[model samples]
Target: MKITNETLATQLNHRSIRAFAKKPIAKEQLTAIYEAARHTSTSQFLQQFSILRITDEAKRKAISEIAKQDYVGGNGELLIFLADLNRNAKIRQHLGQDIARLQTADLFFQAVNDTVLAVQNALLAAESMGLGGVVLGSINNEPKKLVTVLELPQLTYPILGLQLGHPAQSPQLKPRLPLEFTVFDDKYPADFSLAEFKDYDKLVHQYYDLRDTDRRVDEFTTQIGSKKLAAHKSSRDEIMAAIQDQGLCLD
Candidate 1:
């Protein structure tokens, strides 16, 4: 394919930036990124999402601790994206509509999808402007603690944290599976094989082992298998209860 637009190039070269320089992002840049995210599509136009930029140093440090990712607080900005239905719930109360309907599993997943889409837009906007970031799944390590720290309201659930800044390192671009393995035609393929992943596995192995001084130290299969079999952290075990506490009754 022809490298037509710089925007397309930016997306094609995307990589998770873990380390960052100590520079601060300008206010205009942040506003632009937020505006980009605001325009993303939402489920039924619910716009069930919120982005909290962690500005306070102590709070950032505390969240970093909760996430157990020390690099989190060092970014130009740290934003906690939330799947929020609380605003809609309030609107429903005013409109005399049923609030219980929002508690279903469908709404729960839809809100999560909406939140993720907005976050991805923000990431793309930032990256196009030469900014870099990392998504923090580690925030799930202690979701309850995060809720307390952020003081999130009911009907709102923390989905993911994003840390953006001037990149301090340029890691190699990771490999991706071929279209045949991912993109399907009219129907699902009758058969699939683990062996099809072998070639991609070699590429990933080389990427880790040769990219940096501190290598990835494991193959793709090993990584997936280990993560799959790994026990959940104590706090994450109560996820259903926590979601309910946030007023998201996915039952």
Candidate 2:
């Protein structure tokens, strides 16, 4: 076996390729990607995840409106990962099984964990095949509307959306915060020491976001500082209500 720079090959080459060429992926490969996702290590083998392939033109158009990004639905393959407890909910209901308060936390955590693991497996499978993707959290901006439009059941909730396609542009590798900032030992480290930021800040200030070409991105602190929560509380609250309404606590 020949030793190659596998880690570098994985990390140094990752770029979110939004622009995909006109090539379409084969059905066999699509089946393989879903197969990879199915085999992902799920918590308790509960398999609490669902994937919605938004292939309908009108539906994708409406979803694109919700996401506020035209490119999301315009992609070659757009998938929405979901945390679905609906399967077990119906199973238990039919079996006359009752869930207790103690089981609530377990169900919540398990679904979240299972869905994330499945999404990761799918993403890695795509990357391994040289396909590129971007996970869009913007879908959460209108969770209830997303649920209604997708016709998701009571116990199923959208997690994140993934836009994947053949790489259309080769972009540069973005730098990461140093090891000290990211890699932690047994326990979490103290707040980022004031002195440690200078180097990282300098490194960050050098890069520009392709989302806004020509202008240099603001420094990290400034970006975070500018981050404002919406004046009106929304979908997050609605989703939580939906979660509780799904009968996980047996209330």
Candidate 3:
């Protein structure tokens, strides 16, 4: 397929990195990545998001527990992005507005979405700069602890963590489902068959992910079908409570 320069290549080759070389990142690159994040668009200019760079060794070690992965503590840079609305709410409250009565799921979603976009922009920027990283949703496991640890104020919650470093291993590009399978016109359709993936699925199924490090991993279908996505109940409950505590009314 015809494509642009590094932009398309970097995005098309996106993959998670578990092993990072023990090298540290230079200050200029770090500054560039954060600058890229700053340019990302926000929701109605509210800018309801914040980023916390974790440079303290003890803190990194503590956060790695939430991820259950040691590489997070080892990566050159570990960052936590947060969805923040409390600051704005406090300002509105000072102006005689009821913060609690004015918040809803949609507002919470907006804050989360803005934070997420900034994270993606940072990821893309890092990739462009020849730095590797992985976004971790696993940190949701200890949202309250995270808030206390980072001393985050009200109306803000950790969205996720990022691990960045030089790549210690070269993993092959894993295949994806056909684009035609997901893209649609004006009206949404759900009755379409999964027929498009017959070949693509086999290609992906044959790929042996390298993270296992010693031998071949499971086939794509087997991995997806047998994966335990339900292993995260505490995270779900706590996140819901965090948002509620932030003055958002989900119900």
Candidate 4:
């Protein structure tokens, strides 16, 4: 038997909503969403994350261009979740404490975890209220440009972009790998086979994406083996430099 509730149902039925209605989210609802994000558990109670709600038209357009997604600037709310240690660093400095540890790889990952957790909480809150949205990792296509665009201070790095609003289109749910292939025993399984993914690949190839209804997307395994997964020369290649430029010493 399947054990579930309204929250589980909402999570299982999640679909990326690119198009949004012309209506605006109410102030109260937006506040509730923000509160949900703020209340998420952080690393050792150090809330090392900040949410930037982009309302400026020019900035939105610039972000859309950076993401290469038109819908990013079209409608709904754009919130950039940032792994932020700048505020905490300032606090430590004010108290006459050294902020050297704030730049370490450990602290950087902690902030990233805090930021990601907050994002899921905020998205669930919005979805519970009948809103839909998409997580935009494409925002990192030009990491340095994005840093410049947002004027991010030291000890802060962009983690993800979330666009939320009343959904205009209902896209079909994308398929996922079965639990047997993902969930393992206490120790890792000895080995796996490509044949295990055959059925899943067929299912994915059959599902039509709303982005391009004319033709079906590639199979999951095919996509995994494609150039899409290959490292290429792009602004994204300089992501480490960009993060270092922001004074985050990941080493």
Which predicted model would earn the best lDDT?
4
**All candidates: TM-score:** 0.93, 0.86, 0.87, 0.96
Error of 3 at 20 (Å): 1.8
lDDT (Cα atoms) of all candidates against the true structure: 0.88, 0.75, 0.78, 0.91
State the lDDT of candidate 4 residue by residue for 37-104, as single tens digits. Answer: 99999999999999999998999999999999999967899999999999999999999999999999
**RMSD of candidates 1 onward, in order:** 1.8, 3.2, 2.7, 1.5
* TM-score result, candidate 3: 0.87
Write down the worst ten-residue block by lDDT for model 3.
Answer: 227-236
Clashing pairs in 3: none
| Candidate 3 residue-wise lDDT at 14 | 90
Q: In angstroms, give how far residue 142 of model 3 lies from its true place.
A: 2.9
The sequence of per-residue lDDT tens digits that candidate 3 reaches over residues 35-142 is: 988888988888888889998888888888877887877858999998888778888989988776337777778888889999999898888888888998987777
Residue 176 displacement in candidate 2 (angstroms)? 2.1
On TM-score, the leading prediction is 4
Give per-residue CA lDDT, model 1, range 190-231, as digits (tens).
Answer: 998788888878988888888885666556777788866687
lDDT score of residue 164 within candidate 3: 82
For residue 14, give model 4's deviation from the true position in Å.
0.6
Backbone clash count for every predicted candidate, in the order shown:
0, 0, 0, 0
- Poorly placed runs, candidate 4 (over 4 Å): 209-214
The 10-residue segment of model 2 with minimum total lDDT is 242-251
